[model samples]
Target: MQQEKESAEEINELWSLYGENRSMEIRNRLVEHYLPLVNIIAGRLAMSLPSHVDRDDLIISGYFGLMDAVDRYDIKRGNKFETYAGIRISGAMKDELRSRDWISVSLRQKIRRYESAVVELEGRLGRSATDEELAERLEMSIEQVHHLERQINAATVIPLGEYMKSEAAIAVDTDPHRSAEYIETRETLAKALDELTEKEKLVVSLYYYDELTMKEISLIMHLSEARICQLHTKAMFKLRGFLANIDGI
Candidate 1:
C-alpha cells in the first residue's frame, strides 16, 4: 500500500515536470523516472500477444509513446501525465501489431464468405453443418472449407480498434442540432486523437474499441490496473484540452 502511494506521488511529480515545458534536464529526469512504468506496460503487452510478436519491439514502441505523451500533455488542466502516456503506449503497441500483417485481405474475404455460408446453413438446417457438408455445398475441399472457417473464427477473436468518428455518419435527419453538434465534437476528438502518441492512441482503441476493462487491459499490457486507469484519465484530459485549444482557434 505504501509502495503504491509512493509510486503515485512519483508519477505526479513527473507530470509536473513534463507539464512545464522545462529544459531537457527536467525532461530527461522525467524519462528516467518513468522507464520502469513504461517497461511494465510493455512487458504486459508482450505476454498478452502471441510468441510471434516481439517483446523487445513492444517495449521500444512504448518508450516512444512515453516521449510523445510528455511532449503533448497539457499542464494547465491538472491532468496526470501517466494517464496520457498509458494511452500513447498502448496505441504504439497496436500500431506495431497492425503492421505485422496477421491477416491478408483475401483471407478476410474468404473468412467472410465462409461465415455467411455458415449462417445461411444454420438458418436452413437449424443445426451446424459438418465440414464435409459445407465443403460439398461450397464446391471446395473439406480441408479448404475448414481452413476458411478457422480464419473466420480467428478474426472474431481479434479485437480491432473502434473508430471515434462522428455519429453524423450514422444519424437520421430528425435531430439537426444534436447531430451537428455530435459531428463537430467527433471531428474535434478525432483530430485530437491524431495528435496523441501512438501508444496513447492504442490505449483509447483498446479501452473504447476493444471494450476491455482496465484490469483486462493491464493484464494484456503487463501493467498494473491502477496504471491503466490513470492512463485513461490522462487521455481524457488531453483530449478535452486539445479540443478546447482547437475550438478556440
Candidate 2:
C-alpha cells in the first residue's frame, strides 16, 4: 500500500513535470512509468485468446493504448489515470484482435443469428431463456445449439469486454457525467447476474471479476476447462441479452 501511494505520488509529480514542458522525454517517462499497466491488461486478455495469438503482440498493442492515454489524460478531471488508461489499453488490444480476426463470414453470421435469437426470446419472455427454448426458437437440434455455442465461444473476447467495460471511444473524456452511464451498466449487470445459474455465476465471477484464467477456474470448480468455458459463454450471453433489452446500454 505504501509503495502504491508513493508510486501514485511519483506519477503526479511526473505529470506536473510534463505539464510544464510537455517534452517527449517527460512523456516517454510517463509511459515508461505505466508500462506495467499495459502488461497487466495484455496478460488478462491473453488468457482468453486463442493459443495462436501472441501475448507479446497484445503487450505491444496495449503499449500503444498506454501511450494514447498518457497523451490525452486530463488530471483536472478528477478521474484516476489508471482507470482511464485501462480502457484505452484494453481497447487497443481488442482493436488489434479485430484487425487480425479470423472468424469467417459464415461464422460471423451464425454468431449474429444466435445472439439475435437469444435477445429476441429474452425480450419476449421477459426472463432468461432456457437452452431447450433456444433450440426450438432457432429450429435447431440440441446438439446444433451446443455447437453454435462453441462457435460463439471464439467470439467472446471483446464483446464480453464491451459488457464488462466502456469502449475506448466512449471513455476518452472520462468526465463525471459518464459516471451515470457506468453506474447504469453496473446495476444492469448486477441484475442480469442474479438470473444466472449458480455454476454460471461462479464461472463469470472467477473468470472475470476475480481475473482468473480458465485453467485456474476449472481447477477451483473441479470441472474441465472446456466446461468452464461453456458456463462463461452462457453467462455472458445471458447478461448481454438482458442488457440489450435496456435502452441506451
Candidate 3:
C-alpha cells in the first residue's frame, strides 16, 4: 500500500509538471510512468494473436497511443488515466495491425464469404447456423469451415471500445450535442448483442470484461481453445453485420 501510494504521488507530480509546462521532458516522464499500461495491453492482445505477429511491434505501436492519451486526457473527467490510456494503446495496436493488412487478401476473401454464408444460412434457418449447416450452404467440408473460422478468429481483433463506443458517445452528449446518430448506433449494437447466444455472451464477457486470456477462458469453459475462437468469431460477425446493415457501410 505504501509503495502504491508513492507511485500514485509520482504520477500526480509528473502530470502536474506536464500540465503546467507542456515540456517534452515532463511529457516523456509521463510516458515512462504509463509505459507499463502499454505493455499490459500489448501482452494481452499478443496472447490471442498469431505467432507471426511480433509482440514488440504491438508495444511499439502502443507507445504512440500512450503519447496521444497523455496529450488529450482531461483530469476533470474523473476517469482513471490508466483506463483511458489502455483504450488508446489497444486501439493504436489494432490500427497498426489493420494498416499492415495483417490478414492476407486470400484469407480476407474467405472470411467475407464465410460471414455472408453464416448470415444467409441463419436468416433462412431462423436460428443460429451450425458449422455443418454453414459448410453445407457454402459447399465446403466441415474441416474447411473450421479452418476458415480459425482464420477469421486470428485475423479479426475487435477492441471493446469499438463495441461500446456508441453508448459511450450517447452518455457524454449534452443537449445541443445530442443527436439521433448516437442513439441509432447504440440501438444497433444492443440488437446485435441481443442476437448472440448465451455461450457467445459468456465468452465475450470473460475475454473483454474479465480480461482473461483465451487459454484461461477455454479452461474455465471446459472447451478447446480452437472452439472458443470459433464462437468468438461467429459472435463478432453477427455484431459486425448488424452495424454494417444499419450504417450501410
**How do all models score by TM-score?**
0.46, 0.76, 0.87
lDDT of 1: 0.60
**110-216: candidate 3 lDDT, tens digit per residue:** 98898889888888988899988988988999988888888788777763345553344334435554557667776777788889999998888787778887789
lDDT of 2 by residue, 1-249 (tens): 213333777878889888777889878878887888988888777766667889999999899999999988877666778878888899888889889886779988988888788878977998667779989999999878887786677668865566665633355545666756666677787888899889988888787667788889999999987777777777777877778865543
Across 1-249, the per-residue lDDT of candidate 1 in tens digits comes to 113333766767666765665667666666666677678777655544546767788888888887776776665655455655666676776677778866668976775565566556655876445557778778899767655554443343223221242232224234677666657766777787875556557777897666675678888888876556545543553454455543322
Model 1 residue 196 lDDT?
57
**TM-score of candidate 3 against the unseen true structure:** 0.87
Instruction: Please list the Cα RMSD from the true structure of every candidate, rounded to 1 decimal place.
Output: 13.1, 4.8, 3.4
State how far residue 163 of model 3 sits from its true place (Å): 2.0
Worst 10 residues of 2 by lDDT: 1-10
Candidate 1 has its poorest 10 consecutive residues by lDDT at 157-166
- Model 2 misplaced regions, further than 4 Å: 1-9, 54-56, 76-79, 116-148, 167-177, 245-249
Candidate 1 — number of clashing residue pairs?
Answer: 16
Query: Which prediction has more favorable TM-score, 1 or 2?
Result: 2
Instruction: Estimate the TM-score for candidate 1.
Output: 0.46
